[model samples]
Target chain A: MSEHNDTFFIGWSNDISAGLRRFLMRAAAFVVVGLCVVSALLALSITDPARSLFGANAAPDIPLDVTLRGVLSSEPYPFLLTVGDAARPAGHGVLLSGDGKHAAVIDRAALGGQVVEVKGLLLKRGALDMLVLSESPRVLQNIQPAAPAAPVPMGRWRVVGEICDGKCGAGIMSPGTGIAHKACASLCLIGGVPPVLVLTHPLEGRQFLMIADSQGRALDRGVLRFVGMRVAMEGEVERRGDVVLIKVDTGKLRRL
Target chain B: MSSYKAVTWNRNKLIYDAVAIAAVVLYIQVYRHFGAMAGRDGIAPDDATLSMKAFGSCAFVLLSGILSIGPLARLDRRFLPLLYNRRHLGVLTCTVAAGHVASVLSWYFAYSDLPPLRALLVADTSVAQLAGFAFVILGVGAFVILLVLAATSHDFWLAFLGPRVWKAIHMAVYGAYALVFGHIAFGALQDARSPALAIMCALSAATLVVLHLLAGRKGAVEDGQFAPTAATTPWVVACDIGEIREGRGFVVKLPDGEPVAIFRHEGRLSAVSNLCAHQNGPLGEGRLVDGCITCPWHGFQYRLEDGCSPPPFTERISTYRLMLDGGRVLLDPRPNPPGTRVSAVVIPQAHQTPVNETSAP
Candidate 1:
């Protein structure tokens, strides 16, 4: 049998030929190296750098609590007007969402002119800020409602970018926008998370805006279906403090 | 090689499983760590998302690797070692795929009104939308098939269901593979900012298709050689007696596409079905060891005389009658009842089979 030096494999027997063992070792090494290279390439190439707050305090962490004292506004979706301290000079308008996918639970008429302290977990990124409300805000007795900056209407403008839920965009979900995040974003929007227009190219140096209908309410089904997808739309662009707001024309919203 | 129904663990199996596990770990680790480094603007994606991609990519790599082994073994005998204990590799792949499903359910499908699994099934109802249609359904289909394959991978199931039925069931791996390809093409590929998933999917499909084509070409060439004699007589001349090596088989392809393995052992020739009873492996590719034909795929041994696996192993394959008409070796096209003994045909001294050196174990 040794005359031809024929090598065959037997799975039940451990008496493998020395040559086969060496060959297998080499094969294994080659396979492992190939797999690692492919894996790294796949992981590297598909990477999206968008940040999220889900991990390490950026997201819906169970044990995170933040308090902000601000004037509650309901003109363009529910927002908290915070007085920035020394660390944050430019005062902020924070978007708010409820515990789950719902928007922050607040009576719009009662809180329109009230100064209050809002408590929630913050999802912050760039100019995007969202407070996932722990409960109803505490209306402060002593704090006076400060007159924040007036909205500067920037006329009719055409814009392009993805439509994402405000909460996820601020930091709740990393890579919180895109077709991959579409279903979740749709659920969020349907469940009352405020929708926003994340611009493809920053218009007037702003990448995001709290987007709503002409009535300043959540977008209807026609626009919400485009969530997590890039869309081009015409909206009334207005600058409010460090943040931006847009009143989108439903007829002009087209998926990009 | 085993009588009982359990994983037939051996040194080779241990080594094979260890290498498979290491490969999976290395792939996932490399993906998770390098995915961050590969990100743009010095920012990494969320941990949940990164982990999901890591497991997802690792499962793809493993499934691709697993599918490649069969054609590779067919093309080159050196790769047969990979074929040994391949079920473990299959089980590992399913486990990794399960991890991917879990990650998606926990992170993306969670915190919603619908239950995670139900949401996974019903999340994307846009079946007509090409870009982001119901790709999850394809993934679910593939996962179910993988689950079935993994569940029935035991030898007991093989024995219980019998080889033909088991093989027919396992053939659904290709269907699962098709579903997986569609799942990636429509699902992940749509949102991937880069074409990595597309490129990877293309390469995997190309490799499997090209390798199978090459192996099929080889099979066609061999099967074509002996088919012309089928119309003339039932006793087709397979080859010259000397064409078969000592202690090895020369496959004779009948016109109907069935092959019979004719082995030269102890200065005589014996014939058995070319298909192994286990996994329908190519028995003609195997060689004789200790007076029995050992299937190269999993080492299921059957005596050449009766085509019966030795006493403890209750498996059998059909045997055939061989005739030495002078120097020409002719074979009967019809297969005898499995495990029926047929006496080996002795070669005359002029064609004496090399002093019986192969008789020694």
Candidate 2:
């Protein structure tokens, strides 16, 4: 019975040679200390100045004073001036009045799809572009309703991407997507930042596109549920110049 | 109870805590500073957000390390020193976690149309989403648990709540750990392209699981083997009378799974429950101080005969009957009701085994 009591202590010390035990202890201590030092160094060295974890897809914000004639759409957030022969999402801008405060509100329901010339600062972030209004647009002659161009079908494809507000997703904020930024992204999208579908892979010449319904109308509250999630969307893609517009069926959006 | 209450400050503990906290702060600052320097295309530099992420990550790491210590200490006695001041580590971890929560609230939800708290709660109520409820909510849940545990870490709360209640409450750290794990898994790691973060997270989780499993297995094995044989009668041969040192105890597991501490004090043999009333610390691991059994954990004392703390202290533990037959000391399997006075058994000089003994009084 007394000998059994000694087994506890004896079992603990007898498992390993003292020299080997000392060596292993020292080695473990060294590894642990080394890991700590390395972690510290890595933490100190890894900086995300631009928050560009995805890709170098940011386009330089070229300041422009040029006035342009284009159609203004109010639905998926206000943006002006379409590039190329067709109305492709060229640059998104806010309608600012003389006082510089956002012109209380632009009656997008009435004026949407109407061609007008406006002047403002051209802010470009990646493929998404925006114009800060310098003054109210001079109602340019509304082009006689041209026969709606035949829907140029690019191709129906499945792509996985995050649904984020164009303003922040286009490098306005570092890491503008993900659960941490989900609430903020929802606010931005709700606040009328053009909701853009950033594709995980470039299909055709477009990696980013203005997300709209099947009819190319702005999807406002319908997309709130999918914001900040990587979702697989089967949508028809239409390319006009550098912009690709994805016409998605809201019911078909699948969370990846 | 010893009518003395001294300040709890220990120089070694203070130094250790200072170094740990300083290291955490330094690591976070350095990581944020460096990460900000490496600019990504298009994204504007927001130092506030960067600092938030840095501190948040550091807090997570600290929490992982803190949780790992329990299993580590169980696996190796050398790690016991780490256990003594673990409350300080937990408090510091909570402080860092609070910093993370504060930064997120200020930067992410501050400018929202709704109040910050409301916005955080209602941000994304879509339970159907793959990302789960706003990860912020998970983080908040974890933070609240940590706050509660940290606030109640002192001995006053332990005494007020009692050891069982206090231990149950503190076990909520596991709940916090689960919440934080969800917070990270769905939040930061959602759209993360870097595998480094994923690997680190997996490693931290694996280390915790493996260490706990190993320690638990070892403990189960020890508990199983501690008892030599089932007693046909009430008296079980605990050990040789000589095996116990003066003023110290030889702990033996009864057939019914209760541990009995057979103590040799003032040339007499007495038995009490090995478990201390406060915190359930092993009383057998402690020694007699001024003729009363002192608990190794919180200095809770019980008289050798009655297993009751002296006057002004109402703590009581179950006492057991002990007897000496020849060279062997036998402990009665049945425990007398707690605080019951049981007479001590004396070993005759002729039956005392010849063995070298150290006095622990």
Candidate 3:
């Protein structure tokens, strides 16, 4: 009787061990499969719309076409239009001609510091504004050669800003001005995307300013290296109708 | 399994390939549709950029799946089917990645004043920036490695390069994976505001680590339990003769964690390394086909007596000395040089004893 009892206990223990091993194997398989399923689902679930991910600030819904009399400064690549009183230090934005279909060719240097009447679409984001010119700006009046309006009191100030291509920076690409975007920004700038200086702080109702050389000329290829970097530059700050122009000395541009 | 020509198309493999392709297409289409729908309000990206993002993200997801299949199969034999035709998966991953590269080049770099390739190289040389240009270089490096692996995934290339060289080349996949991780981390993720992507990457990495650790631990434990008790002697008790059936093998792990496969055939036993010389497939999992030990992976064969592939094929695997003590089988832990001829240990009972019916332990 005692021998039978010992055999029964042994058999029972063996069965228990086999059951436990089977359970563990099943559990392991379950865990592995579960992890794979969950991971795949997670990957699928996290994919945001490309627009939201890449194009954060898109074009405005309602396009406004208006004519404004402003001062035009051509130091930067794409000319800037300072609306209202140029001496008041406010309301400046990018001056672009023609519709989105074709690139407009306007010799900005020939029309620097002249009060002009421009007709274009008014694109605004926050305090930053871009006036897409439908036609050539008609010079309403020129700064008198004698008085010169004291050169609008050009103040030499140091400011930090990222240099990015204007078209994408305005509404095309979200967070477009960064190291990751440096290469794309360079490409766009080279392809004539109007290099725009995005200021770290809002200056007189403008966060973006067109960048150019000290003599109010379009920047050369030397600025390509500083495309996506936040750099400090001592530049003469001038505003014309929601557009700010920074005449940066190429030699003084220091990467911050 | 030893056919010398192209891959034989079968129903199961055909179905698997079709399903995989369809799944990828469906995933991309669905994501694009939903993504576009979600972006109806004020943030609609242009179709070109949208398509690029769709293809790029699709390829990334496919790559993640391709990487996960290996560890998943190790954890569960049910996942083994995924491993059997993994070369197809790799090729598909390369194709998808190529699509992504195409879209990026065309949309972003094509119209640039510089040539596309030159643009990619010289556009952003900012090494000190937060999203430095190095990420693009890393991406290119990973893509190149993937391209090589995909191009050489055929059996012809496997035979030409030999298994050892082929395996070393394939191992570069891990390096590519590391580069890709850096590419995404520093590139797209730099501006990513959502936590979902970050969490998914972390989970995938953790899953791979855990699976590999568990698989390694299981092998280590098995080796530890049956390691030779006497360290001074080279001989270790492998198992009883009854543990291996005729024309089959019983795998035993040596003290150093090398698995040796002991095969029983015609009242004789021989031992060889469990790792196949080609692709490192488990020889023990394969059967004796035409008296040669066939590898389960690619049907690479070696003679049981000398651990050498037949002439015209010079691949060799290390063999061990086996001794039968009464009914118990003992294996010498020390391996004979590759291709060295070693005599088999003959059982004493010979033809008088019937083969055991019990399965291998």
Candidate 4:
């Protein structure tokens, strides 16, 4: 009986040894797998693209329609222009006519006071146009020289109304143009929030719409909340159909 | 005299068990790192899927290795020492499989670029990704079985469930193994280009087949050793009054070549199949505990008097009719319906022969 018991003990020991061997082999396999995975991850990190993923805030270079409100001086021969400021530097303006680049630019002092419209090619060099006057510039927008000479009292007029046409309803309010809707759509699509749009339109009363970009950026800049506020304005006015263009010099806009 | 008890414990197996578990955890960490790297490369979805495949395949390899260790030991007793950590290997395999499932789901939801709610719903749906769904289900089932087995591994559960019930429920590990194996064969091997994976699969299948064949051969060998009747043409007396030792069983055979195991406990004898139902492990070479026989291969137990398992497990084994002759034991080869109780026979210790010799000189 003792011999039998001794044999059983030996068998049990053998079984235990087998178990240990299996355990060691399994452990080794796991270590190999782990190391391989780590190496792959490191490789991926070392080879990623950097510049295009980060530097997206630079302003676009291609020309787009820009309208700013400012005071115009009636200068030599009823030239409609704004008072020169350092920020708005003077530049050589090329008049776009039937002949192309043939028109000349008048000096800023010559067109400082007269409330009139002068449309040509807008060249970016300094504050105002700084050259001798040449041919007559075609007026495509705003008040013409023969239209209205009576200054309608240079105090302050609250903006009674504003209407956004074309793609302007996208929530990107840029003073007096029409390209706000695309930006608003991008914000809505990405961030899942809408920017509040407040604008006083002449025909449709004051309206407020939550604007969102298609990518969902939303009202991150926080500049659209004062759309209905009263602001003092001093600029030569021009009306093309129902859209009024106010090229103003400066104004104190206080929220109502 | 210390009873000359032959119960030797292998301490080295415990160390090996710890090492295997640590290795599996380490592999999982590596797999996760790879997944992260893949994601950063703008290939998160592919990385996740590949990682899951790797995990499942790794688990299958480990499990097959663990299961095969027992049969390898028979080829050399020196290898028997490795068997101690087999259960740990199994548990570790299940854990790795669980991690693979989690990683796959996370990647599916994260990189599919769907809305969170939509991702969750789509993950549950079995469209366009049948492999993922099947893998998840298999992994979940294996995890549940592992949890139960791990919880009940203590001696307390052995004493609480009285061995028979515990062994029966634990047999589900094999079922889990089968499911996971199918999941990998159908899913992972599809995209594998490595000859290593193909070799591993072939080796796993061959090892399983060889191990089962050895177990069946061991059963036959035990039966042959206890011939019981050389003169009787059809009937044979399997055990003797003194041969059915306490805490142990003996495989006996009749002239018809039918095999049965006679278990002895508290001076009583009852018979069951020599083949364990769980993995076809030889029951005659196993230990008798709490009035049941425990298969030495994986510790599955069955009641001797009646084949029914304890509560919460409904598996049963074939029982044989035992008759008491003049100081000898006779067994009918044909098995009675499972769960039917048979009369017990008192077996004396004088005629019993020891199965193995002591290691101590």
Using TM-score as the measure, which candidate wins?
A: 1
Off by over 4 Å in 3: A1-73, A80-93, A96-162, A172-180, A199-204, A213-236, A247-256, B1-4, B38-41, B128-133, B221-248, B252-259, B265-268, B285-321, B327-361
Docking class of 3: incorrect
lDDT digits (tens) for residues B1-361 of candidate 1: 3534566567888888888889888988998888777355445677788888888777777888888898898788889989888889989999999998898888878887788887776656666666456677888899999999999998878877878999899889889888888887766776776777888899999999999899888867543355346334778888888777787788878778788888888788999998998878878778788888988898888998999999877788999988877888888888999999999999898987553446532
Model 4 spans with C-alpha error above 4 angstroms: A1-256, B1-13, B25-54, B73-85, B111-168, B223-236, B239-250, B253-361
lDDT of 2 by residue, B202-281 (tens): 88899999999999986664432244552547577788888777767778788778878888876789999988886776
lDDT of 4 at B329: 69
| TM-score against native, each model | 0.88, 0.77, 0.73, 0.41
lDDT tens digits by residue: candidate 1, A126-227: 667788898898889887777656788888787877888887777677677777677777778767788877777666767677887865566776764566
Please, what are the lDDT tens digits per residue for candidate 3 over residues B1-361?
2314587666446645776676667656665565454333344444555565566666666677777776665555445446657789888878877877786677566665577788887776666655344577777888899999999998778877877899889989878778777877867665454676677667667876787788777655433245464333678888877767787667888878788898877778899988887578778755675677866444567898999988777789999998766777788899999998999988887432635545333
DockQ of each: 0.44, 0.23, 0.15, 0.03
| Worst-scoring 10-residue span by lDDT in model 1 chain B | B223-232
Instruction: Please give the lDDT score at residue A214 for candidate 1.
Output: 67
RMSD of 3: 8.7
- lDDT for position A65 in model 3: 77
Name the candidate, 1 or 4, with the larger DockQ value. 1
Ranking by lDDT: 1, 2, 3, 4
lDDT string for model 3 (A1-105, tens) is 211211111111122234434543564455345434543443334322222222234343344777776566554455554554633243445546344312345
